[model samples]
Target: MSDPDADDREGSVPEAATPKKKKPKKKRAAEPSAGGVAIRAVRLSRWYGKVTAVSEVSLHLGPGIWGLLGPNGSGKTTFMRMIAGQIKPSKGELTVCGEAPFANPNVLARIGFCPQEDSLYDELTGLEFVSAMAELSGYDRVSAERRARAALEEFGLEDAMTRKMGGYSRGMRQRAKLAQTVVHDPDVLLLDEPLTGTDPSSRHQILDALQRRATAGALVLFSTHVLPEVETLTDQLLLIARGQVVAQGGMDEIRQLLDEHPHHIRVQCERPRELASRLMTAEGGIVGLSFRGPDVLEVHTWQPDETYAAIGRQVLESGMKLRSITSPDANLEALFHYLVQRANRGSGMGADAGTGAGPRLQSAAEKAAYEAQLDVGGGR
Candidate 1:
């Protein structure tokens, strides 16, 4: 069977069936200008013999903080590793700092990578681990120690600097990893799940440090499954799924693609039934409605702005006490779920089929499957 998600080119249609009106050109994926390009990949693919980790993917990024948003096993780490020169691509081209990365010490020196795996030496203290990384990056012992101390303190690790790596908690260990990655201040930073296992205060500090790096013209690309974390860091996004670039743009552009999906809003008020009844009678835009409790109503509407406006007018005119009004679908998580569902459907997966699980669950399943495949492959 033909893939349902395959793009239909204009030339593929019969000449007789062609419409007289010209169709709008499909927008090409976003690309960075040559002068500002920090990383560029064309048809990049990576595989582990029979298993493909990253499929043919292309991306262009410049000097700024970019969110590499995807669930675990969605090829986020594989792609980052390729850019960091840890592995060579099986096919296609990739360049960092306008030079091929694999086996090139000059390019590698300019790129800093913090792998997801905990690779710290247990015998070393937090300060020693970060200082060792700086020394390896070509700094003298004295300077390395200075930079390491500064980085560690910047990441809120000053009090724990003397503690052994094995004795640190998960959050503290994550901070130590980040401190080492940024100690040398490389031009390009590739951080995989950097915010994982971090406390809120530590997350804030790390984010601030990353933002500072971007402001200083470093190309920062960090991957994460957490949607809110991405929103907090940068608006630029490179969304990946099923080992492919599903979308590349800012939040607004992504949200536009999801306009067809119903927007869900929850309203807390003293008069739930009255408000729901008035909304139903006054507006035909609402597509779904349910009562969460005696004073709360969940509403789904195709026209959110109109629905919201109606709600505001009704509450004031009827003297109804309104506690709060919020839209659950107003964030990146909802957008990711909507796009994943659409992708599945387009690729011949029915909405009710086993393949149509939402992004969160689908991500978990993908992670499990990949890990199992790795185990069968003898942990390669």
Candidate 2:
């Protein structure tokens, strides 16, 4: 056995042996700066005794309106709770206003949290609840009520401010909650489904207030399943699924991101074969092609917009008749679906975890997997 492959194993001689390739040194994850109104999570994770709610997540956010988009049960609530000091992270370093939030009085005082559930006191007037909330933020009786009225007016609850919460509609109650949340005027705001049942008029007013808060330099992080709301509220986006961040970016960054995935586009034209042939070899971005009909071709490409543009140009240049081009998965829902599916299939999306605001490094929290046994076993 030694004689048979000895020459190949040693490259014919010791001096002729190939040099082993050295592994690339991993970069250290950068620490998020702690100052002003900001929230930073370094591989932040939360577990509830056998259930992993939020897994090794990291992000560095500053004063702005950052949309936390995720479907129901996507751990958005748990993540917000962690930042709001309601629940301590099982493992990882999380900082709100530069301090660990859990059980930290100063930090808690500086943070405002609005949970998804209805937490209003039924018998208390909308003004009373908001005033109580202000008092909890350390204001005295006179100033608390004063700020509460102003906050209520700002959130469009002026007409219902004196009415008992039990008599309030869902939208009115939501406004009361918002009024309370802002009565303290904390630097960091965490709102979970803040616009749940609000009508158009109320939604506009609430959205306007949030936009103002962000413009005023408060770090507002709100979670919602509605994609358009995120686009409407802020260009900043942090999309999460399965308790992990799938992608995050502004409009420009998102467009650049789409280039990294294959987008299938259906092309309807007079000559499908001619268009397919022209696209099959266009300086290389096309993944594959399928004929859907006599005048239709479904093209899979890494660059959809570019491919679509090229198709349009070719039709004009060759005098070929073109009908229309369409992408079935160009929307946010489809984008999330595609990314999650790829991550599940081990396409390196799971391995590539990090916020653009921070370096992508294997977190120290990875070694804490032994703590996984304590998790409840299913993610929120």
Candidate 3:
């Protein structure tokens, strides 16, 4: 695993200037500048004894909703803990807003963290717990009360604000925890599985609130096993597998990477008998081929480039008509399965869950959003 912090370290390396100087000095501009921070992790890593919880993972997140995606035991929670400074990493450095996050008052003051575990005081009413968090975040008494009430309203929890958290259902409790996380109006928001146990309606409300926060310039990041949620909410994705980042960047870019990788190719054409006979007689020979219908030819080949080229040339040379030449298995799900399978086979960790479950399809509110996008003539 590569160190997360290492990404910025190479910036410190100096190139020799055109003119010689009395003493060679490293160029400071080569390194990433400091001052404002949404979040920065340099070679950040954590381990529990022999089992590494989070490998050396480095990431820089700006002011936007970024998705932290991975399966169980992939270190999403561990990494979030390190960001809150609750758990120190075994090696590497982590900084929030240009300061060490662990036990750093100034840094903690500007950051809001909603841990995966339920942390509400069982005895306290929702309002009391939220007020407490506001105070801890340094809000004045009057302001804390006002802000807590307002946050509850935003989450559609105004009615439940006075109810004891212990009696609240799982969905209600989750919303209460979320309200408290943002009571102080922190500049950076970190949420771990914030949508878990939440109903479809509650999830939409939370996601809406998160979007508003990010649009207001807060650096918001969240962890989830839900793929559709990630795809819909945020374009930027950090995909982790086995405690290491296997993929990152926007969804389209990641999809492009998968397309570039070598995989089996399946082609269907108009002339099954002719195409199969020609392919089998060609130099590469068909890896596998079958006829699904009278005119439909299913040609399978390990070499994508070779098969496509041969098929194209055959069409041109033999004057054979062709239909669709689609790769039936080319998709994100296939790519995800391949990567997970590869990691499992290589590491011998069959015990690890294969892949995280994607979120259920959009709720009614989400469907409205999707329709809105279409109304604006937006691409999916």
Candidate 4:
């Protein structure tokens, strides 16, 4: 994927950028310049032995809710962990707020990370856990308590703030984890699957809180495999497949990218043969048509809106009874698969090639997310 402000890094170069330009004597922090990039990466990669997890990913991300989208083992978690300074990149340069994050306490302080594995202390109350996080981020005891409660309220966990996390439900526990991540009000937030076990109400509240933080000038980036989750959070996206970026930008750009694929409209009508015949005489809007059954017509068209409009007019003018209409390939799963299939790879979206779940799910949440994207009556 090529970002507006980032250099193209699809191919291997002569040399990768070196890290550690300066040594830190203390936990000193730094912020990006006015109107500067919040996070930047160049040829960033991570590997284990001979297997590369993230490969040559370069991005220029500013303040917004940027969703890191990919399938199982697409390296979303590894890429995020590198940014949070939990793991060092094997190659390339990564900076958060104009400073290196790896082993740098100051830069790490400006970043909040909510890991996918939410391992909490069963004995501690939600408020106590969040307040401890705040204090660890340099807040005093009194201030930590105040900020912790406020953060909990922001995530709609005010009623359960005093309860022990072990006794809390899955949704409540996720919210508490999010509260601690934002308790210090870090400039960059790296959340991994924050909505895995959330209900619809909790999902709405969590998305609203993230939007508020983005509007307040904080860069909130989260990772998720679910399409609806990202769509509900923000339009800005960084799509990756097989450890490489396949697409970036808003929904419109992604839709436009797969224009070559015909938009399929499945319609059930009283006279399918007559409808197909009528559409055959129209202009260049339709590409082809086939009969699914005696009363069903499946249309392939380049322009769905125009073709559907024409179909509607033909039905109304000819007094044809139309039972139902639906687009089978208009959802996010189709779009994502299209982009992944179109990605510059030599093999299928399977195994190391990315996006397929033939072998590599590291956690139960990943398996669940992958299963959620699967169609009930169709194959990918």
Q: By TM-score, who's the top model here?
A: 2
- TM-scores for all candidates: the values are 0.74, 0.77, 0.68, 0.75
Report lDDT (Cα) of residue 142, candidate 1. Answer: 63
| Better candidate number, 3 or 4, judged by TM-score | 4
Tens digits of per-residue lDDT, candidate 3, 1-380, equal 33322322454322332232334463212111244535766456688999988765655666778788777887888888888878888886778878888987777877788888865688999999898898787654555676788777777898989989998888888888898888877778889998989988888999999988888777778998766776678877666677765665565566555543454545555566877788887755356777777877767555666788888887777777677777654544555555556554554232222211112224767534433322111111
User: Which has the better lDDT: candidate 1, or candidate 3?
Assistant: 1
Q: What ranges in model 3 sit over 4 Å off?
A: 1-34, 258-260, 263-334, 347-380
lDDT of each: 0.75, 0.74, 0.69, 0.75
The segments of candidate 2 whose C-alpha lies over 4 angstroms from its true place after superposition are 1-34, 258-260, 264-284, 289-298, 304-306, 318-330, 344-351, 354-380
Better of 2 and 4 by lDDT: 4
Ranking by lDDT: 4, 1, 2, 3
Worst 10 residues of 4 by lDDT: 12-21
Ranking by TM-score: 2, 4, 1, 3
For 1-380, candidate 2 gives per-residue lDDT tens digits of 12322442354423322232122243121122335567777678787888877877766677888888777666889999999999989988898888999999778888888888976789999999999998788665666777788888888887889999999998888888888888877788899999988998888998898888778778889988767777677877777766777666664455456565677888898889988888877744788999998999899888766887888777887788778888866566666666566545655343153222233454456534422321211110
Model 1 spans with C-alpha error above 4 angstroms? 1-37, 281-284, 313-319, 344-380
Error of 2 at 327 (Å): 5.6
Indicate whether candidate 1 or candidate 3 has the larger TM-score: 1
How many steric clashes does model 2 contain? 11
